[model samples]
Structures are given as C-alpha cells and as structure tokens.
Target: MREHLEGVRLGGEMEEPRIRRAAPYRRIAELREDEEWVKVMGVVVEKKDSEIVLDDGSGLLTVFSDKEGMFEEIGVGSQIRVFGRPMLSVGKEMKAEIVQKVDGLDFELYWKVMEEVKRLEEEIR
Candidate 1:
C-alpha cells in the first residue's frame, strides 16, 4: 500500500509540472497575431447554426467552426480566448476560423457579466 501511494504521488507531481509549463504557450497564443492569423481574448456573444461570434472589446468578429458540438457547448458571455485566422466574407465582413477555446475567467465580475448575458438571452427566448 505504501509503495502504491508513493507511485501515485510521483505520477501526479510529474504531470502537474508538465501542465503548468504548457499553460504559457496557450496564453501567448491568445494575444499574438500575425499577417495570416489573429489571436483574441473575449466573451462569446452569439452563436448560430453555422457561426459563433465573439466580442473582444475592439469589435465583434464571427468565427466559423466545422465542429458544431464544440461550438454549441460554449455559452454567451463566457470569457474565452481563441486563436484563428482572419478572412473576409462575401459581403466584406471579417471572420475568424477558430482553432482553440482557452479556459474561462473565474472572477466575480466575470460571473456577473455571464449572469446578465444569461438573463438577456432568457428574455429573448
């Protein structure tokens, strides 16, 4: 039993360090953009059958995702960080093709904003 517990502890210690090291790359990707791609951090504001929209304070941008399930699970006002490439729609609207959804915020302000968005959505429904 003692040996087994030591093995479990060692496994957890090793895994925790790896997860921590990988986190910076994820956050860096959220704020860096290049000529062909843009990284953004914001809240999910709207979602439709084919697109998801995010409001990043600078502006509202639509994101197209082929995986509908991944898109559907994200709720409005949920703080998210996304990395994607920008493209122009036929009508000249800008859009992003999302590659990832980073973790959400956990502060009191974030919770309050999420609540307000949920209430507004309920009203619209």
Candidate 2:
C-alpha cells in the first residue's frame, strides 16, 4: 500500500509534476525519432493554429498539439516545459501531451547541471 502524502513534501521544495523530473531532459536539437517520450524546456518563439515552436539554443523544434486551449497560457517569451513524444519525418517535431508555464526557472543553470550529471554518469561506466 502507498503511504499517504497528504501534507508530506520534499525538502520544502515547491510542488512540481513528478514526471517533469522523471523524464529525461532533451535539448531541442537532441530530440529525434528514437525517443518515445521526452521533456523539453525552452522559450516559445512561434505559434501557429496548432503548432508552437520552441528554441533552446541548440535548435528549434515545432510542437504540435491538437488539444483545445493547450496554448492558452503559452506565448512568445514564456518559459515553458513540455512532455511529449517526438516524430521524425522530413524534419524533427514533437506532439506534446502536457505543457505548462514554469516560474523562476534558470534555463542556463538547469542545463549546465544536467550536462554535468550526464557526464559524471557516463564516466562511472
């Protein structure tokens, strides 16, 4: 049986979607067909009727969502986190299942730490 988590929290940290940390973070340029699901954080650069583009300095990725009101809170310059599946066709793109605006996110710092973690993990092997 799972323990009740009614008021329990971690290190007094803000509540966040668990999967946001569970999913591996991938840069816009690193996303490809091999990944079944991914987590990407970037600034919104473009928005079309059913698509939104994100840029993470690595590259640009077009995210398509058919859900109504999906982009309601997302806009240009908004820092957003996305969890989705990527499809590789002529070019790379993603179909997001969850998107949310993130506050107080340090994009550069986060990426830097993640990179170091990846490097250390690879070195362990």
Candidate 3:
C-alpha cells in the first residue's frame, strides 16, 4: 500500500508529461529513405491541384496533400513552411500534414538561427 504510493502524491498526482514536439526542420537534401517526419521551408517552384514542389536550394521535393484545394491558395514563388512525413518511394516526396506561408522572412538570418539551434540541440544530446 505505502510502496504503491512511493512515486505518487497524496492527491494521486503523477509527474507531468513532457510536452510533445513537432517534427524537426530539415533541408530537402538531408531527407533520407528512413526519415519518418520532417519540417521544411522552401519556395513553391510548382503548384498543382493537390501537390506542390518545393525548392530549398539544396534540392527539390514534392509535397502532396489529400485535402481539396490545399494548393489552391499556394502559388509558385511563395515561401512556405511544411510539416509532413516523407514518402517511402524512391524519389523525394512527402505527404503534407500542415502548410504555412512565410512572408517577409530574411533567409540569411533564418539559416544562421537554424544552424545555431541545431548545434545547441546536438550539444544537449
């Protein structure tokens, strides 16, 4: 009885769960066959009814969405951030879960910040 409550509080509370995190950002060139999820930011190089092609400078990736009109508002030349799972196919492809347009971003500064964040994350690990 007492042993069962050793890690539990008097009010039956337990440790709070860690906050769930979204996918990590990755350059298109860094995507691999084994990658499950990723976040990517790129310019829209092409746009179709259900898919859009993103170019992050390193490479191009195709992002498909099942929702109708997902790519309707997104046009070529627009910068966007995409959260999705990579496709299992041979080519560079992903199934988009969320798409967000990024306006007036400084690419050079963003890259620098992202690099620093990655370095910190690696150090923590």
The global C-alpha lDDT for each of the candidates, from Candidate 1 onward, is 0.54, 0.86, 0.87
Best by TM-score: 3
In terms of lDDT, which candidate is stronger, 1 or 2?
2
What is candidate 3's TM-score against the reference?
0.79
lDDT of 3 by residue, 6-120 (tens): 8875666689997757788898888876767789999999988899999988899999999887777789999999988888476899999889999678766887899899999
Candidate 1 Cα errors over 4 Å, as ranges? 1-34, 89-125
Model 3: residues with Cα > 4 Å off, grouped in runs: 1-20
RMSD of every candidate to native, in Å, equals 12.7, 9.1, 7.9
Evaluated at residue 2, the lDDT of candidate 3 is 86
Between candidates 2 and 3, the TM-score winner: 3
- The residue-level lDDT of candidate 3 at 35 comes to 68
Let me know the TM-score candidate 2 reaches against the reference structure: 0.78
- What tens-digit string does per-residue lDDT give for candidate 1 at 1-125? 78767746443444344221111111222333333444556667887776777765546667666665656666777776555555543321224445455554553465467558757878999
Winner by TM-score between candidate 2 and candidate 1: 2
